[model samples]
Target: LSLTLYALPYTLAERIAGPWSGALAGALGSGGAFFLFFANTTDYIPVLLFSFVGILLGFTLAWWRPVIFYPFIIIWNFLLFRLDERRAPAQTPHLLHRHSAFWDEFQRLPLVGLDTHLLLVMERNRQEAEAAMAYLNTTRQRWAARAAQIEQDARQLMACHSIAAIGEAYHRLSTSEATDSASALLRSFSRISQDVDAAMRQESAYNRRLALSAVEDRLDGLLRELTRSNDRYAARFRPIAAHWREVVADVVQQLAEEAEMRQEIDNPYIIGVPLTEKQEIFVGRSDISSHIEQLLLDRRRPPLLLYGQRRVGKTSLLNNLGRLLPSTIVPLFVDLQGPVSQARDHAGFWYNMARSMIRSAQRQRDLILPPLARDALAADPFTGFDEWLDQVETVLGEHLALLMLDEFEVLDMAFARGRLDADGVLGMLRHVIQHRPRWKVLLAGSHTLDEFQRWASYLINVQVVHISYLREEEARQLIECPVEGFALRYEPEATARVLALTRGHPFLVQLLCAEVVALKNEQPAEERRLARLVDVETAVPRALDHGSFFFADIAQNQVDLTEAEVLRLLARQGEETAVPRQVLVDYFPSLMALENALIRLQKRELIERIGDGYRFQVELIRRWFARQPA
Candidate 1:
């Protein structure tokens, strides 16, 4: 009976701690029981000896297999109770009552009750631990699946070769949900893919093949590293690595075959394409940039009109304004020729504008602007856009927002098509200029405000900044040193001849120089380094051939019959000679008609008046006209 009472503490310790702690606790409890109840008794020696041995055996069994510990302990205590009753039958009832009273008192004790509550809490904690582990495993599995999907998509993107496909892939990668490292790695590959495509377009086939081979080698190395990696993050790129390497190897072989068929090398000059902010080919435009800065400082914040003819580098200048302006001024450039003008309604227009503004702010200044969702603009587009701008202003703090709308004429065309309300758009611009102290509006187009009567009223006090052909020195810098490590050099006479032919027209100069480079490359290795007067003369026809689109636009789209006639007559007079107004008048049916044609031609920047006569603005253009059918 005494041993049965002592076993309770041993069982409790086992439940709370483990078998070793239970054994230690049982030994202490049994020693106390022996000393307190049967210290000098030898009559019940067998029962006492059996109780001690049973406790040892039970605890030893518990240590070996904890599953049976509680049952074994209960049985051992029951056997001891029977043994106590049999040995001392006369005191059985008294001993049982004492045992019952002691158990009731132990259960009532605060520490014992508290231990029971702790056991309950521990059981609850065990359940919670299992639940947490299950959740972690599920999360890891989900991430593994996501990584697999990203790998598959990346492999498909790697197989794409066309610029349009690569552009679509980039858009998909940029907008899709992805891990940061995965997104960054895919964007890097997208840029490399674009470089490969550019080499195919601009360099020789042999060079393109070399580029493709290099890409293959790079992919192969990445495959080896990814295959060996055991990290979870590396899993995102691992599945794509081997397949991408295979695709690149196939592309390299295809390119090598194409190179063997016919290898034609294109010159490095970038013709017709507007220089991006990343391109180092853009030369000096300090004057225009300085003028813009001064206008930005004006307190009234008048709307600016950047007027220039087509292909005069208006877009390029706008693209680069973020670099030229103060860091406090953020340039949000929007090409109205793109999706902004193609929108079907006001909601689409404002949404596209807001999207462009956000993108440009991030890209140019690394500043995050408040996002304007399309759905937010579905109710009231203008109001929603205005609210978004208010949030953007908060983010900008002390910065000024320069809103540059390039190819504003395209938006006007949209207005004419009734795709957007001209009044609402122009009124918004006027309101921004007048009401928003931190915002400035600049419109870039080929035509002046007077030509667009609808814009003239809304944009009051418009400050006109004319962008024309490069200044002579700027043009010379562009020709001689378009980029660092330029291999081609021009003799003094050859450089003068190029300037005479191009008249510092940016497009014409690039076109002519590209042709000159192509011509030089075809020469002997020794002759290829230096461009002579003969080389310049030789490149003129090729330049005219390649730039026919630019010249044709001027003849067919910009000028009417009367203006075309005037230009052809000027061309016939030669590059150095300026045909007088009287000479043009005799050719026309009436003087009024000739004067109007001349004014229009001058507005187009196709011809310039020198003292009472007009001549072609660019000699290369004159040469194009000289080759045309009379």
Candidate 2:
């Protein structure tokens, strides 16, 4: 009966165990009982047999893995299967991993790319040198003739006082392609030309003509700076000219290797599209939506300021606000890029706003305005718009009208340009909010709260909410959740690398993951189940270059010249630290210019005013800014 009892457990365990596990279980069960049977006859025998068993049991018990493996073998097998699946197929590679050492040496790049960037600079300079050498070898005289033309124009501009002759000289200098660094050198000449043009055009200035004559000394000083200093390129870079081919060859080799590596990845990840809006790929912005929801639920219904850097998921949040907010408030997406952008003045704004509000209210709530009032809004919106808003309020008594003005910077731009009356528009909105407590404005822009108040003065009453980068956990969700459907995963290490590289910037997180997924598709089908370390190393550079296309215009279009120069100066240094106030002051020289540039950069959220100096709020922007060519 005791044997039967022991045999019953062994049979049940074997039924659930795999082939090897079942055999081991059967052996242990039968052998243990047999040994015990003999041991029962002698205390020393039992002690001798159980001594080793006890030791092993004690060790194995602490591990719990081999002992616990019985129930979790399926999970273990799954992991093994995935690991085996990612192993590269046995074949000769197109590029024999030569760049592995290159990557090893430069692995700290992207984080501290300033030194590595010198390689690119040197390579570019050498290529220019080679081209110049080729041109001199091909037609030395024609190049010399153009050089003479540039020199003659430079001399004439310094001494010649005629404005017409100055314009011609500037034009000649602008259109030249002489010398080794002619392309970079002309930028200085161009700025001087612009300064001369502005000075000559100054109608009110008393010393305009004298200021224009200063172009002579300006041209002389600039020529010295360019020819002597070699502005953006190295004048004596020829020492490393022989080693230049290695840098170009390295990138080329990496590209070829990447192409081969990609051939193994199928259906790689794609970017240039948002994730959360797609619903299937939506991820963690609960950090944002949760606060917005609670704010919406509040009875105050005060105006909101949704501020973030460009492309930080502000539009996505706007699209999702209605779904995430409580049912008490109605969110009508007021896209200024929509028909509302055509508003040129206060009257036009009222007309366009009424059209949008009526259309949105009807579609969202199936509530239609009376035909008479709708006609009144379309014809004379300046007066009837207020009445129609009252009717909308009557239709939904307790429900609030949460007006989300996206890209509200458009109005600020229009106000700055004098096309829209800022006081009139701001006053109208303020009056509406004051009378109708449930009617609140939710304004979002690439600018800041101080800017809104500066433009309107009435916006001082509004509440501002700054949207920063996603949290690490949220960023992880963005990286992992979307790829779940493809039965693909970024290996935990690769995921951490992504989080570290992007630093929880949402757009960057999405963009990098998308590049990773696309790069992943190039791998052999069998090897694409998980993103590996090499895959991350390969994808980062490509992703950075690709994503920078979106940011290339930020400095050009967003800030003025002095602001851009300050930003560039900061970027050139790389990394964030407490820079002395004097450093920036020296960069700008003028106190007013320095203060204006810093303020605009702050309002744009490009950098922050922390401590005595400032640092980039988004490290990725700093990385991007650092990579920019001088």
Candidate 3:
């Protein structure tokens, strides 16, 4: 029972042990060694007749006081050692064992590595010497042989004079103390040598140009021969190049097919097809909806501004809000895309509103809107605007119409270009909101609020809400939702890569996912499974290369691969404090377009302005960019 209890504690201890468990085991062994040396020695031992008790004493006292048990082993060891020394030396002879110095050295071996410093120094020196020698050989070969021969002859003639002077000077020095005239002879030899050197240098220069011309003539002949040979060879292999071209063309077509498969939404505003299963509803401006909802719930209206960059989804949000309004309230969805003439014709807007009301009211004809909308539509298109609006108020109560005007800022742009009567249009809209307190007006557009602030009287009546991109967490979940499978979730690394690359841009995210799914056959096994996968790597960057396919349509006609290369460079510039601008220009001269593209990207919310530059909104997009092979 006691053993069982002690065993239980040890088992429990083992189950809960952490990093300290190994140290604990080592400590127990060391304590036991000391206990064995001290225990059952000296005072506890009885006098043996012939042989002492052979039985081990630890079995019955295994659970006894540890402190007393430890001291007994210590005394026992001391007495045994004392007894052994006093005994015959034959019983305790030293044993022989082989020592292995090689084994010891092997066990103490250093980690493996080549001598990097020596290798680098040798490589650099070899490269420098090779380059210098190649340059010297090229220069020597380019010189005229005839001129060089003349220079060599001149040097030989000069060398004989130098030798004769040295011999004379040696004889003069040995014979007697050098005379003052000896210096004069030496000076004359130096002048003669200088004259010879200058003549040789001139000859050498002339020979170089002649030799270069001759080399060029030989090179030109060789080039012509090589070109003829290549042309013949190419003619022989014409069918093979054609076959390779066909294969490449098939691969490109497959990529396009893959893109079409991945694109989810087939809409004009969305730049690309959706590749993932995530739903992308462009809610451009929620402030208008929230304010409208507030008015319907609390019976109050506040002016609103729906401002964003072009194609930023502002118009879509208002359409959604109009759909959400109750049937009792007439929802008029208006498009201001037409010319100012259409806008100024109040009767056309009223006619369109009547048509929308008729369509909705057809569901409940007995609700009184049917007859009223019918009567409005039956009226002439050129009917007085004031009379039509008054008739509309009489038909549907003053508080019934939810007038949603999309692209209101188009008028501002039109007026700036002198395409519209701005005062008349403003006066008309201002009159509708001010006179009809019951009517709720929602104005939306893809312009900044500052651009349309001039319409204060009309805007002051509604609330403005800025609808932005999905939060990082939301975007990540949305991106991975399509690929999440029973076998594995998206690996953090793979998901991070996707997010990092797309930067949470809705269209881009979907487009990228579509491409990825096309590659993976839409199979989701493990998150980071794509870490080993290859990406779609083909893109024509004509803008980066001057006169490329893309730049021909642009303003300066300077197309390039700069945008593509910049993306790659930026991804590799991870954690860098700053990257020099010249690095970009040196590699791809179209870097100036990057700033313009970045601004456009921001407007579309592909990237966010942080400080000096931008970061991907979706980290996975950045990670995906990082995973792309250079």
Candidate 4:
């Protein structure tokens, strides 16, 4: 292709100018011709040879004046093309579109002629083209008018809600001496923000015309205005929102002064109160509760397993259950990390349980477990635990006890000898499950319960509840709750982008929202304005870099492996859409250890599985790795 374009000047010069001009043109054009021959030749020999020839030729021309080179070639080409044209055959010029058999015609005739027949024909075609353009213009105008009318109607419908009232709060800040007044107005607007939102959604849904482009744009605009208004309202009132919360609580207390607070349903669903900015807590475990109730609530001897990947809220679920259970149900929550080093026997489990039970009893203000805690500490931690359990059962007479151990897989005997196959703890759990009538064991870990069952063999009738990723609607609701303060909203594409990036992980979702909130904080007053509570732009790559989150512990872990090899492998495979297992094995010879390392890395969510291999879990990390010097 380069040669074709390169030869054109020489060919034209030879046809019109003369041989001397064609030679000068060809010599001048040799630089481009060199590129064609030198294509893809990066090897040392090829590069060295080309460099030698170029240098030798350039030195040979040291005596010639380089400045006159361009003009001399141009003059020479002018004579060559004139000479070449004379030798060429006479033919009518025409543009042709090649097909297998049939040829295509050009709208503009190529043959030059000065006659009434051709002139009249060309004039008629020009008129037809102008008429088509005029018709298109008329159609466009009609569509524009219809769109404008739809927008007007949609805006009017939007105005019927409190969105405009809330939006007014944002505009109020532009004026001086109205900041406090704006805050007050924003508070007033917050009281009915959701009501206004519900109304807008109803209006948007019922109006079929909103599906049209004009109406849809109008609807979106109004929605955004409302969101910005609410965000402004939040920003204005944030300092006082906590105080407002106390005031609301005081009011609720006053209303229920005569009633029992515990019996009454407190506002668990944060529908009206704006969730505090930067306040993070694990909430909403209805599924976890339901599974617990079905498998362990009424059972006499239940061996229940609650398994999910690390940080999937397995511990949170158990804590929620502990809060909800009655005093009659003795629930002991234990962090199982201690057992691997200290819990060599049943004595360890008992001692660990005693302290855990004391904490729970203290939280509940129950005096029933005080003596048991003290008595258990005096004996071996294991013997003390068994004695305390018996004493508690004797005191409470007929109550049931629920022992919840978190990260229970750490107790595996395999992990004890620097492996993960622990059958001893599983046997102890099985013994408790079979022998105890009023005791139920709830074991939670990052791995599946079947892993424990395989080792124990005696863990019969144990119910396994698998905690999976949240459904789309659940994740959206979770995100929507936190962003209400920002009044930022996400377009559907933006929502999907966040979900895809985080893979609907709860902690990851919170991290993304925090980043967006930080972005909003850094913007200037004019730039800070937004239409939605969780807009995509605030979460886009330009909005934030999540690479730091992925590579956070890289410095810490670099000492464990060859930093260069680990980084190189990750840099290559992590950015890949998918990496083969063999590629990883080849990259890291100690792949068995590397696999374990990768698992630990996955728990941190620095990478995610793509079919058989993995990809960087964060986009910024992928891009960063891609740009690294090889």
Best TM-score goes to which candidate? 1
Write model 1 residue lDDT over 1-630, tens digit each, in one string: 555654776788878997567766776576455555665676777657855765565456434443334355344435544554355333322222122212222122112122222222223353432333334235322332344344445556655654335434544453331335666567556655665556456444444555566566766776776677775656766655555566666767776666445333324467777776656678888899999999998998999999999998898899888888889999998989888999999999998898788778976898878777788889998898888889999999999999999889899899999999999988888888999999999999998999899999999999999999899999998888887767778899999998998888888888898888888868877677888999999999998998899999999888999999988899998767898878777778788888898889888888899998889888889889988988
What global local distance difference test value does model 2 have?
A: 0.58
Q: Write the per-residue lDDT of candidate 2 for residues 381-413, one digit (tens) a residue.
A: 556767767777787778877787888888777
Relative to the true structure, candidate 3 reaches a TM of 0.38
True-structure lDDT of candidate 3: 0.41
Winner by lDDT? 1
The per-model lDDT (C-alpha) reads 0.73, 0.58, 0.41, 0.48
Task: Sort all candidates by TM-score, best to worst.
Answer: 1, 2, 4, 3
Off by over 4 Å in 3: 1-292, 295-300, 322-330, 338-383, 390-400, 413-420, 473-494, 520-630
Winner on lDDT between 2 and 3 is: 2
Candidate 1: segments with Cα more than 4 A from true spot: 1-152, 158-168, 171-200, 203-266
The per-candidate count of clashes, in order, stands at 0, 13, 59, 37
Tens-digit lDDT track of model 4 for 373-444 = 334445454445555567766765677777777776556643455433245445556766777777788878
- How does model 4 fare in lDDT? 0.48
Write candidate 3's Cα lDDT for 1-630 as tens digits. Answer: 323323443345546783234223333433344445446666433323101211122222222323344455334434443454455544422110011111111112211111121122223353432333333234322122222222332233233433223223222221211233323223333433342333223222222222223323433443344345544333332332233223323433553455356532211122222111111333223344555666554444555555554333454454455444555666555566643225444444445544444433332222334222324434553344545567667777644676666777665766676645566566666677667666666667655555466786445655565555545665575456532231123456666655655455454444454444334434443332342223423111111232122112321221235444555566565632233555645666455677765555456443455555555444433444455677
Candidate 4 regions exceeding 4 Å error are 1-280, 297-300, 323-330, 338-349, 361-370, 373-383, 394-399, 409-428, 448-462, 483-488, 525-576, 579-630
The 10-residue segment with the lowest total lDDT in model 4: 95-104
